[model samples]
Target: MTKMIVGLGNPGDRYDGTKHNMGFMALDLLAKEYQTDFKMEKTFIAEVAQTFVNGEKVFLVKPQTFMNESGRAVKPLLTYFNIDPEDLSVVFDDMDSPVGRVRLRQKGSSGGHNGIKSILTHVGTEHFNHVKIGIGRPKNGMKVVNHVLTKFDSEDNSEAQDGIFKAVDAIKYYIENNDFTKAMNKFN
Candidate 1:
């Protein structure tokens, strides 16, 4: 069976390296590690790359739609590929955990994440997998929007990179084992 691994983030150079794009960053790293590259697929409204893990077919996707509207791209891709929602895994930034932390869950609420919210609405389920890289909450009364869009400060960059790498490893583990619970037990 084939599986879809989605990384949540806004498209364009403007969004690169921002705290909100941790998912994209992790996917990029995964692609490079696997010696593959992403290509934009207009029909899917996403940048997609194909790779394999433990002999299983896998697709790595980065939705081209902006963050809040990610499902606009995701749902179509899922339908086109005839993939079950349970076979989908999502990577995204999470403010609920501190930097350098990676968390895994089989399913859960969006936790105020707009990108995940979009997926839940369009995909119509909370039963997929989540690989979250922590960005930590904004401090000193900073606005949430401002914090997400902004690049990580110098103090946070190293930690964020650690989190992203950990997230990628977690995804690899999940895809190879085909067991979300095992991945969660090992990584979370």
Candidate 2:
């Protein structure tokens, strides 16, 4: 069963509310709904919250190592906990998927996501669970870097609010049942 959940995003005020930080935002909402709070942990380079979901211990982690190097925070946590790859689920933003859409996968390659690439390098495998939150591609052939770092405007923000909540619910369901298929069916 899954035990650790890591949300990938750059840390700090500058990235706040941007498309790339959607993972962090969704995880924060999940933590709040569970009545828990994250504490900064020096070793992991992330804010971590521990709680039980349906009697299973769950760790909610937000990497502080910036987006590209997110695995620096995740690898150690997995090692310390002795968690299997299947027990670690990463949530992160996806440029290809349309905004407000979510995709869940049992395991796969990073598909060019730097954060997931780093994690795969650290963990030595592509077999791990992931929750991909869509941020949508930018118009006019804009660079993905610029697109992801941009903040959502009013209309996008409204859509995101609802989307984030749905992602949170999906996480809860996954933790409780270890059923990614059910989660995708329900939330996708």
Candidate 3:
């Protein structure tokens, strides 16, 4: 099966440096590693790049539908490509983990992330792989929405980059081994 990676984030320049857009940035890193670029696909309502990893074809995607409605981009692409969810992987930011940390999971609930919730609903299953980069939750008196949408600090920005590199390595491991568990064990 062709491997599919869906990186969740809002579209446009306003969201450029926010932690919420970590997924897109991570995929951007992957694209750079493969020396490829994304082209906006009207059919999928997303920016997509195609490249090979360990001789396996991989599709890197960034939904143009924005963060809360990412499923709109993901579902159609999966259908159009006739790709199975088992061969799919999602990369996104997670507030539950601390900065500089990431966790890989084979399956899980959305953990209240609207983008992930949308994906779960559209995909009709929770069995795909998740590569979550830590963005950290809001401190006392801060709102969740504001925290995610805001740009990261110097410390968090540097740490998030570390997490992105780790996520990229984890992705290569997953692609090479065809095993989510192995990626988790090594990178999480």
Candidate 4:
């Protein structure tokens, strides 16, 4: 069975380095490690990359439909690939977790995240896996929208980068072992 790993983020260079783009950033790290690259798949409205982990086929995806509308791309990709929701793992930012932290959940609600909400709506379930990287909540009365759209400050940048690396490692561990529980135990 092919495992589908998805990272949710807005498309374009304008969104690069923002807190919300952590998902995309994590997949980029994995791509570099695997010596693979994403090619835009217009039909799916996503950037797709194929690779192998312990000889298991894996599809790395970055939805290009923007954040709130992620389902627009994800639903089609999963349908076309014929991958079950159970075989899907989504990585995205979580404002509730502190910087430098990553959390893995086998199933859960969106926690008020629009991207996850979209996925849940289109995918029709929350039974899939989640890999959430902490972006922390807005600081000093900063608005939530601005907090997610902006790049981290110098101090936060390093911590955020660390979280991204950990996320990538966790995903790789899951793909190789084919066990979500073990990956969570080892990396969460």
Q: CA lDDT of each candidate?
A: 0.93, 0.87, 0.90, 0.94
For candidate 4, the 10 contiguous residues with the lowest summed lDDT are: 51-60
Per-residue lDDT tens digits for candidate 3, residues 107-163, read: 999999999999999999998899999999897778999999988887678898899
Task: Summarize candidate 2's per-residue lDDT along 101-131 as a digit string, tens digits.
Answer: 8888888999889999999989888888889
Looking at candidate 3, the ten consecutive residues that score lowest on lDDT are 152-161
lDDT for model 1: 0.93
Residue pairs with colliding backbones in model 1 are: none
What ranges in model 3 sit over 4 Å off? none
lDDT of 3 at 20: 93
Q: What lDDT does model 3 reach?
A: 0.90
Q: Estimate each model's TM-score.
A: 0.98, 0.95, 0.97, 0.98
Ranking by TM-score: 4, 1, 3, 2
Q: Which stretches in model 4 have alpha-carbon errors above 4 Å?
A: none
Ranking by lDDT: 4, 1, 3, 2
* Candidate 4 lDDT tens digits, 1-188: 88999998888889999999999999999889888999999988899999987878899999999999998898888899899999999999999999869999999999999999999999999999999999999999999999999999998999999999999999989998999999999987
Of candidates 2 and 1, the better by TM-score? 1
